[model samples]
Target: MATIREELQAAVKKLFDDDKIDYFVGYAEDYGHTFPAILTKDSDPSRLTFDRKSYDNLANFLPELRGSRVGLICKQCEVRTLNVLAAEEQVERDKLVVVGVPCPAMLDPRKLTEGAADLDSLDESYWQEKCRRCLERNTPLADVFVGERVSTPTPAEGWPLLEEVEKMSAEERLAWWRRQMSLCIRCYACRLACPLCYCHQCFVEDNKPQWIDKSVAPENNLHYHIIRAVHLAGRCIECQECSRVCPVGIPVDVLNNVLSRDFAERFGYVSGETAETQPALTRYERDDKEDFIL
Candidate 1:
């Protein structure tokens, strides 16, 4: 049987030969690190590969590639992101050729030993927190699937870290967030890494309103993050890329996860499950619960 990597390379080549795509977004090995690569028709299809390290949400590259037909390798999370993007009208579904892959849970880079070899030999303990709780392993939407379907892991119970934070008193929670904010350098990697944060001008950049101060401070950082969480309340797909890219190692996704859980409980909504469902915040019913409103 052909390995998944070989299958992916062959599939991408076929897409190019079929004139189904103008560009292909996938992972390539460089300097021992697997990183996102944008391949043109002239580029070598052999460069394409997928593995645990192929953790990037490839959909993040799609908005910039608009007006061109693009093919991309998508895991379940990336598929969900595409669904959200399509529903938001940020992407033209017809212009995309989604090559779906079964995700075998990504390894947490932080937990990896130096020169870790035989990544495939590692067990579930080495997986990222999000992966442990992932409910879907196969892409829910795809133009073509390139791998055998993998068995989905039984999802772990509720978010432990979020539960820990919830247990804290109001004052303690405020202080805890302040400490996390203090470590931020305000690099905005969290926003940039997000596939949904495609706004041309984020609120912070608006000089006319000056929504957030340019200087980095705990209060200012907290304000920025709070506003960001609000914006993503009903839209965040919980890919956990924000926390993954945080230089300070702050658990940024916890805020989004909190809202995700609440939305599920209060409104029975889960973001990015399908392209047809409107975002929870985008639509309101006459019977919608407003207990959170003060």
Candidate 2:
């Protein structure tokens, strides 16, 4: 059995040789950090790697490279992101050749590193919380599989963090979130890292109306996060990239996760599960509850 790296190298080399794709997106190590890279025909395919340390969702780079034929190394999460992009009609599916890898989950660098250290010593305990609830270890939309299928454990209950947050009284929850929001420096790293935040003119940047305060006030930070969560309410795919990139270590995914759980419970809808499924907020039914209306 070939390792995933070898198989991906061969597959990408073939794609390049056959001129099937103009670019290949995969992971590479640089300065001891695993980051996503775009490979060309002239680039070495051996640089392509699959590891738990690889955290960037390669699909986030797709919108920038639109109109070019692309071969993407899709982990389960990236596949789900692509599905969401497809749902929003942000991408042309025919232009993409997906090379899927069964995700082994991902590790949080903050847990294993003081500044910058090798991940060789870390165990699964340091893996991201998202992996514990992952149901898509196998690529559901792979055009080609590059490795042996892997299995992941299912948690006894889902949305444990959201449940915990809900258990807090309203005032306590408000105080808790304000503490978290106060840590934000208003750097848009989360917005820049999010694939779904593809807007060319984000509301935060509008000088005409100045929708969100540009200052670093705690209230402004809370407003930004809440509005961002609302924008992604029906579309967030739980990739956790925003939380991963937050310099202040904010648990930014919690807001999105709460909405995702509500969507699942109320409408029986899961975002990014399939491209064909309509977004929960996009369509309405006559029988839908209207109790929330004033």
Candidate 3:
């Protein structure tokens, strides 16, 4: 009996050997950390591994590999990203071979390693918050499913963070965000880490119009984040990679999550849920609710 990792490696190797895919994207362990690895037919499949620490969205590499036949691992969130990219025609579905895995929640190494010397000492509290609320632990869109089926737990009730923020007065909320913005060092780690942010020229990098100043000031940081959030309103897949990669520990996903929730609540849209379901902001309806209109 083979483990899931073995099964995934076998699948990828088979595809590569059969010449069905030109490259493979999955997690490989090296240098004491599991990171995204690109594998070819000549690559060693034995290096591939799966664990809570395999937190990167493999789809981030898809844009760079466009037009090439690619086989890649897909967790629930990564599958959703593929769907969104497919809906936007950013990817050619025929060129992809998806090996879906039943995600068992990713770990936040920062929390689990702060006091613990070994991973086994960590408990459920170390799992990412998004995993607790995940609705798609099993991807339905895989070309081939790996591992045994695992049931996703029912998400806990209520959006506690959103509720807490909603309770803050407008001024208090503004001040709170200002403080968060001040902590940003303009590293753009959040932008670079996001799979959906594949724009060849992001607004902040444009000097022709100088859309936003290239400074580390709080105002510029706020402006950059606001523009990013607006651009991702109906497109973000809530992977939390932005928040995960922030060197300054900003909760960038909070902004994206708030917008996602609002889009779902108001427009009955959830990004990447389905290819046929039009994106909320990309389409218009005569009867669209206008309560938010000023």
Candidate 4:
């Protein structure tokens, strides 16, 4: 029997041989780090691999490759992202091939101790927070399935860090967020890493009315993040990439998570679950509650 990696490589090779894709986006391991790799028909498929460290949401690269037929490896979160992107008309589904893979949950690099060479020795405690709460291990949608399906874990309860913040008073929560925002260097890695933040020109770059100051102060950072959270209120898939890529470890996804939870409870909306469902904030029904509008 072929190993999972070998199977995935073979599947991708078939796509190329069938002329189904112009470009393939997947993960490649070098030294000890795994990073996203883009391959063409001429590139070696053996370079493609997936492991516990293959945590990047490959859908983030789709917009740039819009005109080309692209094939990408989709884990559960990436599958959700693809659905959201397709619904938003961001990508042409017909021009893309999705190769589904069973995710074994990515290990949190932060939790790994120094010299922790043995990944198999770690357990669920070492998994990323989003992975810990993941309800699906098998890709929900795929053009071609590559691996044996893995059983999904029971969904975890509320996000612990988000709950911890919620327990604080409004003022306390504001202060906590202020401290986190203060550490931001304004690099905007969080926005860039997001698969849904595909605006051609971000608001911060607008100088017409200057929506935000160019300074790197806490207030400016807070304003930028607040607007970002509001924009992603119904669109964020909680892949946790915003928090994962933060240089200051600000847990930026907490803001998006708060909105995701609220939308789930108040509007019964879950983003990226299906391509047919419109984003919560984009569509409004007559029955929408407006008690907080006053």
Candidate 5:
């Protein structure tokens, strides 16, 4: 397996030499953990450093460079996010230089900082729960991909947490979720941090529709999140950014993962596989399953 450092070095060097891109959007080493930074000049090619702990979604950086050519690092989930963004016209496909990498699940930031002495050491931190049952570790699409192609265990086995929740009574499930939602502050950090939620005017921010109230009450918080989850239903790429940015440390992956699981099971679908593919909610079959819808 080629290390992230090596792959990044070679990719940046070539991108510079070929003039394939004007900027490199990848991780740069910081005090301890890596941070997302851009390398614009060829003389600064040395700035591109990718390591095991490079976990932020690079797709989140694309919008700022809307009309320009740029190189981006894509792990499995980032690729899904990018494809969805591209399909929705949030990003320009022609202007992007695709760089794919193999992702070995991301470490939970909270768990990593719990007992870890240094950031580099967190490479071995306990990964987020969603990553435990990840279906893809490496990106499936790229113009110039790097890293040894690895295999992931079948994702069809089913999500454990979702099943456990399903085993609960309706009131029990509602109570469980109420506690989690009550912890939220309605900060909108999860929505802002997500690449998929890149709408210029978010539904929550709309005055006319007033899709959700801007209050910090539990009802408002739960309403906002539930609507956010519904809006992203088939469109969510499962990048887990929504969960990652949660201040209260709510396991928001449970929401996205549930929708993703249903999308796959009910529609035989996976988000962001292709820009040409219609999103799960945007299209439907005449004889589709609707036992619960009615």
Candidate 6:
């Protein structure tokens, strides 16, 4: 149950001492909080750090570091993404090291702005609401783990927003989505921030009879979002980065969560429970409740 800084240094030092790694990709204190930074042989241990604002899912470092060995910190969401990448052959398994950590909760930048003038002094109560319902603060799938696993807190039984949306008439739902889509800028910040949207050629970038128009207007925006969400339906780990990175502050995770909850309830599946478990869509059982077409 060491502090993130202590465990990080020990992990890095062990890798280097054993000549097992040439570089360690992890977070180090950055001015006010921790951000991703690569530590090499000559790096200083003083650079390593961990704290509340260390919100970046370290798995984002994997795809970009292709063919190189990596050691990364993972929360439940990040680990799910790494598992998806491994299944796709985008991440090299033998060369990677996973350091799972118990994530208490992550704060929204907007919440950060509303609460504290400085990140260090931000109130614990203002931390993301997701933390309140978190069931798996400590991850199970790590080559080496960092903290004493905290017991998963009992999750609140309802997603009020999702339920409210369900209560909307179809026309009302459509109208609401249209209004939200009107604000999209199509900068792809949401896509880039997502750990699971790592396709080599994202649909928005495809030009051969491109499936979606590039205009940031509502038509294109809605189309793009629908396509993106479908691609992530079963794969999303509820990292909420898409919503977090949006410049216009769209609640994009709402869409992803809708599907994730559906996947869990309909199929009895959850993402990132293990690094190697197959995606639900990738397999099917004959006894599955819906398999009978009669």
- Candidates in order have lDDT scores of 0.90, 0.86, 0.85, 0.90, 0.78, 0.75
Candidate 1 lDDT for residue 195:
92
Q: Residue 147 lDDT in model 3?
A: 87
Model 1 pairs in collision? none
Candidate 3: regions farther than 4 A off: 114-123, 285-287
User: Native-vs-model 2 lDDT?
Assistant: 0.86
lDDT by residue (9-58, candidate 3, tens digit) is 88887898789999999999988888999988899999898777899988
Residue 64, candidate 1: how far off, in angstroms? 0.4
Return whichever of 5 and 6 wins on TM-score: 6
For candidate 1, lDDT tens digit of each residue in 89-188? 9899999998988998998888888988899888988988889878789887788998899899788879988999999999999999989999999999
The TM-scores, one per candidate, come to 0.96, 0.93, 0.94, 0.96, 0.87, 0.88
- Candidate 6 accuracy as TM-score: 0.88
How accurate locally is residue 135 in candidate 1, as Cα lDDT from 0 to 100? 71
The Cα RMSD in angstroms, rounded to one decimal, for candidate 5 relative to the true structure is: 2.9
lDDT of 3: 0.85
Per-residue lDDT of candidate 4, residues 1-294 (tens digit): 888889999998999999999999999988878899999999997868899889789999999999999999998888889888998999999998888888889988788787787785678899999997786888877888887888988978888999999899999998998899889999999999999999999999999989999999999999999999999988999999888888889899999998999888878888888768787777998888777785
Tell me the deviation in Å of residue 265 in model 1. Answer: 0.4
Off by over 4 Å in 2: 113-124
lDDT of 3 at 174: 92
Candidate 1: regions farther than 4 A off: none
**Residue 23, candidate 6: alpha-carbon lDDT:** 67
Per-residue lDDT for 143-226 in model 6, tens only?
A: 888766667767667665678878999999999889889998888888888877788888788889788777678988988888
